[model samples]
Target: MSTDSVLRFITAGSVDDGKSTLIGRLLFDSQSLLADQVAALYHGKHKRTADGVPDFAQLTDGLAAEREQGITIDVAYRYFATPARKFIIADTPGHEQYTRNMVTGASTADAAIILIDATRLDYSEHTPALLPQTRRHSAILKLLGTAHIIVAVNKLDLLDYSEEKFNAIKRAYSKLASALDLHHISYVPISALNGDNIVTASAHMLWYQGQPLLRLLENLPVANRNSQLLSAPALFPVQRVARLDGSSADDFRGYQGRLEQGSLCVGDSIRIEPAGQNSTITAIYTPAGQVEQAQAGSVLTIVLADDIDISRGDSIVAADSTLQPTRNISASVCWFDSKPLNATRRYWLKHTTQTVYTRIRQVDYLLDVQSLNHRQDSDSLQLNDIGRIQLSVQKPIVATTYQANPATGAFILIDEATNHTVAAGMITSLV
Candidate 1:
């Protein structure tokens, strides 16, 4: 399938906010389910609704623990296609403990659907307060640079489809969005159980004039990496160095990796990062054969004119690219491990294909997810904590600010002793 024709999005909200049910409803209503799937829903051991209808949430709550507890625990991915667009939906856990899973699912999403349960709110208040998980998910989405956000106010049927309650919840969330500086937001009242405002318009509430959830998704524009100009700086992180055995006189070496950004052409002058070695692109080869040029997202083997030492974890970029090699960096990170972040502990900082030993220079501040406030007194970050911190790597690495280029700018921290990933971070600036 063409990359441009696909849209990747995630459904996130507090536990029991109807994320799974909403996805099941979308798939069922769009006629994307097969006969066996439909039969399993009806005959499955999971309990049905009072009206004897199949349990929609059972379709996505595939894990035994999840089905037993009726809560999402892991990131569940589902795929479906409509006439207008193809969709890859990630159903993420809403529990705070699984915040890391949600971050992993949303990292690549072009858009996000944040579900808000109407039953939990007190509509009598002028501005209904949103749950903390709701705020946390929104904050992560903003940090990940998810361009489009849809506020799905779910279970409105329980509120008798009250327009006032929906408006109150919307008002409360609007303030939160403004504080977080989130943009391109759309609000829709939905009842995943009753199939309202999902794939088609709901007859129960004519007050909402916006398009149904499916229609909006079908029309939302997908981010096309190729849309950038050809002259844009290119980033190619070498994944592997291929050495082919040819004739005794012919020695062949090729660098294999994906073009993360911009373009690469034959005869273009390129520089290897960290080493600062310059070379000319002698040839470019794709799976099909040699190519004169390759754009972003292409996986090809590059043969350079010079035999300068290059290997895995090294990056190749246009010689004129402005990216700087730095050893110190300031970044915003979301701590995922149960153990708090220790300033003196050594960690493995993996960026692109390169993994370097790093130390935390300082914990600048911890961000309050609910209020979007930064606490300056924070010395360490605990599980599910988002904070700004400075890090010093053992070796210089080429990188840019996350806002400038996410592919080359984001990285993960791994515990050296345990080797488990402890945090996900985005480069804010090179220090």
Candidate 2:
């Protein structure tokens, strides 16, 4: 069976909001946790309890500090399977200090579970408790742009399983989502610790008529977010060059990489970037042998008509029509460094199958998370801040807009000084 059926989702929310317990319940109800693992939760040394019952959250808070503090300090990953689908879950920390870890975990997620404390909203005021003083707003601002979110309003039982309380937080967050133009969002009221409305319908929540969390996750339609991008240009970034054998097929030279966009068929014309040399796909070689065509996510070594020089870091793109290779450019960036992003600071810019030295051109502006307003002429961007800026580069690299194509449009900035990935960027309108 193809692993594509497995959905990769991550849990993220504010501190003391029950992310770990939610994960534990998912594991337990799905019957994915091992017998020993569940037993250890009840009797382990790290168990957190005043009574004899196991603190279910201990299933994820295995760290000494996390157990001592009764909170998650870092990203916790787990895997589980059901007959319908498999899941790779990353329960990300919600503390202000670990916002970067949250971003890292959510970056590749197929779905984002935004855990909201059901009782945290003021129903009269119709607003949430915004942490203006901390990085929570900053973190939410970054995720707003890219995530397909599930607003899981957890701890509903704490509010007496009141649907009104659930709706209050849901309405408040929906306002924020609307202001950010996010529409494909769903709300589920769940008590993660009790497994109520998590894997099964809550006997107490008679007000709800929707599927439980697990059913929703399993039945949610899986579609590539960038399916439309394939209709336009095709981009194949060469990952490596391969030789079949010691002496056999010595004449065979193939360029290997996963197809990034569009489709590639044998006899279709293509080209290598920066070099801009033209060629045709003589053959598309997969472990399944040469097929007539290939699409996005195809991992194959392609044989070209020309023996012209090619290597890793070189891209195979559609010939005749091509994408521009740029170095001096403007981009929308979400700042992830604790130290403010400076125009003078330098970093390594990683694009599709390539990396180059780069620096910021200008710190143009930052965004207001709650209102979606621009802080134009802003002074600096601290960790978790979302901003737009022009970047100067040491060499050219291929890219697309976050709208046109996300996979190739996204990139990370690695700090040259410490090797930490300090920023994420999406091409807005290339300059």
Candidate 3:
């Protein structure tokens, strides 16, 4: 909960749920915007407010098409810092067709703020139905392993700041979260358009006692991946091999890559994956110079004690690590291409630094985003479709389960014909 720590989060919800406005409000109210940006907001041709207040959503809807359509079509990233913490916010499109974009934004996020439009739900009902996009986004967040979730009930000002209405919507969403098995979630009632309960407490709603959205976000704990993986076995995928002239007596041979997991120190025994060659770490080098130890997420070069045939696409893991390379894998995939997934077509599966030709062996089942159930009738995955599939690679590649280590577990399917990314997949198990 250190104030200096950086927090990466995304804003998501159904269309017109105030995703952009909430971000604008946060920036404007927190005084994060500059004088020139503030000037442009007041004079921008798209400004549509009647009371002379700048249209807050314009701050993020920067695309011409987005401004014209008044809808977020792509992932818009904004950076700002408060005295409490630094934040990187991704304002993702809420439209169902742009689900892939949302996935891209939420992939690396530590937390997600799902804005629920208060006016869209029925306050009178005991269990008001939630929006389909709401369910879809929430399910996707869970699938992507976003640890924190804040369900911000927005547009409450339109409903006279009704506490009863907020409670009803909260109850409905709580049930959905329970069904999805999403545990780390918080509830906040907000009015993004009116700037109520965004950065400061709202005088209109006194019944609630929880901290405002900004305060909650500032205090939310961010996962320290490097520290968390310190005890785990190191997994480094070589991206490059640097070697000096053969004539040089001090032959400099180093394998350069980012440490995906665990820690590596001088004298640590390491194994080359797929090759099964054992070597000891003789030296580690960063941009600054040589270092004795390198932690996870560090981009450095490692010189092994033994001369091994290591190259790009090869993994360097701890000698004692239990990871095994496999040619076949069962995974959950989110289809991103307009073309339907074809099992007969060969694809280029890009995992870490390795790219291998692969073919889909079978389609396990398509996940129904709304019901969170598996549909066995579908033979192919369509655009934005989520399905479990079995695939075989041309060669063996080392990987862990997505739940265990996302760095090695995640991969993308590239359509070899067009070279367009067709799918993003998470390895479930080795087949």
In model 3, state the lDDT of residue 241.
97
What is candidate 2's lDDT per residue for 53-102, written digit by digit as tens?
Answer: 65678887868899888888777888898998888888888886777777
Better of 1 and 3 by TM-score: 1
**lDDT of each candidate versus the true structure:** 0.90, 0.77, 0.91
Model 3 scores a TM of: 0.95
lDDT of each residue in 199-241, candidate 1, tens digit only: 9899988999999999989888776646653445888999999
Clashes of 1: 0
Clashing pairs in 2: none
- By TM-score, who's the top model here? 1
* Range of the 10 consecutive residues with the lowest summed lDDT in candidate 1: 223-232
Candidate number with greatest lDDT: 3
Residue ranges of candidate 3 with Cα displaced over 4 Å? 1-4, 122-124, 247-249
TM-score to true structure, per model: 0.96, 0.88, 0.95
